[model samples]
Target: MSKEFEIVREFEVDASPEQVWEAVTAGTGGWMWPMEEPEPREGGKGPFGSTVTAWDPPHRYVNRVENVEDIAEQSANQLDYTIEPREGGKRAWVRYVHSGILVEDWDNQYDAADKHTDFYLHTLREYLTRFAGRPVAFATFEDGPEASKSAAAFTAVGRALGLADDTAEGAKVRARGPEGQAFDAVVDYRNPYFIGLRTDTALIRLFGRNHWGYPVGISVHDFAPDADGKANETAWRGWLDGVFSA
Candidate 1:
């Protein structure tokens, strides 16, 4: 039996996609370096030669990882990135798609495959996920408008990510809490051919593009932090207005 496993992880990065891409493809020196022994390039004699299937510039990079034939059957990895505008400028989300196949000898590397993939991602995520040893946060989901929100003790601020019209897709909602604090968070995505972007979700027509048109941007917003130290829209927004619009 051939068992295939697919894993997809999406992240909202504060900086531009280019910046995040650098940290991701920034050589194999970091803790969670995904590349194995081969130096990643397509059909070339690098460390990851045979396993490293493809490399398509910034957007979509891929990996055809294999471990000891009789050991792990076959493995495949996909990387996708895109930009979403919030406030005004830009933010990005890097969607990772990794999957693999196990044939003939399935049980041999069943569990190992899982572990290997986890560690592999952990490597890349550790770097692009954070910088200067600080853990950054991204919005996975949201439920309100970024414009009209309470900013009393919650604190809130606003900034233009850039100039966006239709490509700007996101949710906007304002909800009050009965607990410690209140806030609003926006989860957005941009699929336009912006100056520094790599792909556009709307034009996800071309097949090869999927492999190369990874996101150039991913962003998250926080307006405040509640008693639990989570994003409190009111407070965070206030802070943003005070700090940036000064």
Candidate 2:
């Protein structure tokens, strides 16, 4: 029998409801998620052609997908965002739900979503907290066949960049990989949770988290112009896969 799966996440954002709403609905360049922005109206088109089922400014927005994209096994999915005022209007409470039906490989699909939700939400918080109105471009790279979802993945990435496990903020980092992939940056923020690197060309963020008892995966965000993003994405994707496999 086909089964349904739902993933829910809630975040306390240090921004007002209006701010959060604007950030969520504003088209590309405002936030990192949604490869493309959906028009904010009923029946408007969303990422991967999802339809906007409901749109209520600064309060509730819903998107439903009848045909899932990028995944052949999953047929349907929906994303819902509920924003509420909190801290007497100084902050916002955000709830996110991603649900769908799975007919095969449910474990892997669910786990992937479960792990990725944290990174996505974290990215949203960072955008709202620091770069709300700034012009930005976000790029994502997926690991290749050599990728590993293990505890040592994080250390491997740091080492690939010539950084120690305890690398701290302000530290200099240089990394090189296959296909002429290279990065030079100074650590902007560092902690066990996440690491932010700043270069002359872009702001890069790396996340390390365990999901479902295993290191989920590694992702790098390049908040820069799109001119160089495609090449960077290809390079980083191959480099990360190689690092984890090593």
Candidate 3:
């Protein structure tokens, strides 16, 4: 078997290659270009940013451990990244390849890749969108028209639940008091990340993506309602199922 292997990652960002190049190559928004620590000048051994090798300009950068042999043979552990302009600069393509594995680090390869690329793309997107000087998250929900209630519907939802303190600001919900507790509370339940809710009595929130992702199936859960009035069992599951189907 080869001492070094191949890992390639590609992303098509909604940015011109030049714009991407700037970020990739340590341009203004690129992660490494401006740190309290000095940035590497292309061929120098980079000390900061996405990779140990300082990001080069114009849409490309690589990271590595200080010791190449720490993970593999002297030449096998280097990670490389390339950014190339495609479609006449209208959009850009990114490529990253990691070479060398001490084999001991094999278990962590995917994790490392995710940390670098996923985080990078998210940060890059935010920077670009902000650079364009407009609101982003509220407008990109499910590829549909922007709804007036999209941004601040938290309290609007509580009122519809028949369980809110109505106020000009919106519906306000207080945590279950110690005496009112049906089930032992663990964490705050207001987060949609922990529980998806129906906006009104009619609409269930469907998650398709996040600003950093277009997720199809997200893993989130909470217990169903019980007579105790706390989320514990699935006593009302059938009703919920019917509501969802209807």
Top-scoring candidate (lDDT): 2
- For residues 1-246, could you state the per-residue lDDT of candidate 1 as single tens digits? 777766666666565566555555554333232234434466643234344455554554555545434333554323333334333425556677656665646554444444444444433443443441332332211222333223311112112322233323344323222232333422222232211111111010100111122212111221112221234334333433333332
Query: TM-score of model 3 relative to the true fold?
Result: 0.38
Per-residue lDDT over 1-246 for candidate 3, one digit per residue giving the tens place of the 0 to 100 score: 234456666777677766665554433322212332325555554433223464556656666654453334233455566777777877777776765544444444434444444434544553443343221111012232222124333333333333444222223333231123332222222333112221111112223222123221111122122112222113232222222232
How large is the C-alpha RMSD of every model relative to the true structure? Answer: 16.1, 4.7, 16.3
Q: TM-score, each model?
A: 0.37, 0.73, 0.38
How much lDDT does candidate 3 score? 0.38
**Total backbone collisions for each predicted model:** 53, 0, 10
Q: Which ten-residue region of model 2 has the weakest summed lDDT?
A: 210-219
Error of 1 at 100 (Å): 1.7
Model 1 scores worst on lDDT over the 10 consecutive residues at: 201-210
lDDT of each: 0.36, 0.69, 0.38
| Backbone clashes in model 2, listed as residue pairs | none
Q: Across residues 1-246, which tens digit of lDDT does each residue of candidate 2 receive? A: 457999999989999999888787776443354366778788898777799998888899998897787877688899899999998989999999999887777896687678667756766776777667665555564333333445565566666667788878878878554454666877776655456666664556665543223442334444555545556567666666666554
Query: How close to the true structure is residue 156 of candidate 1, measured as C-alpha lDDT?
Result: 23
The C-alpha stretches of model 2 lying farther than 4 A from their native spots are 29-34, 143-154, 166-227, 234-246
TM-score of 1: 0.37
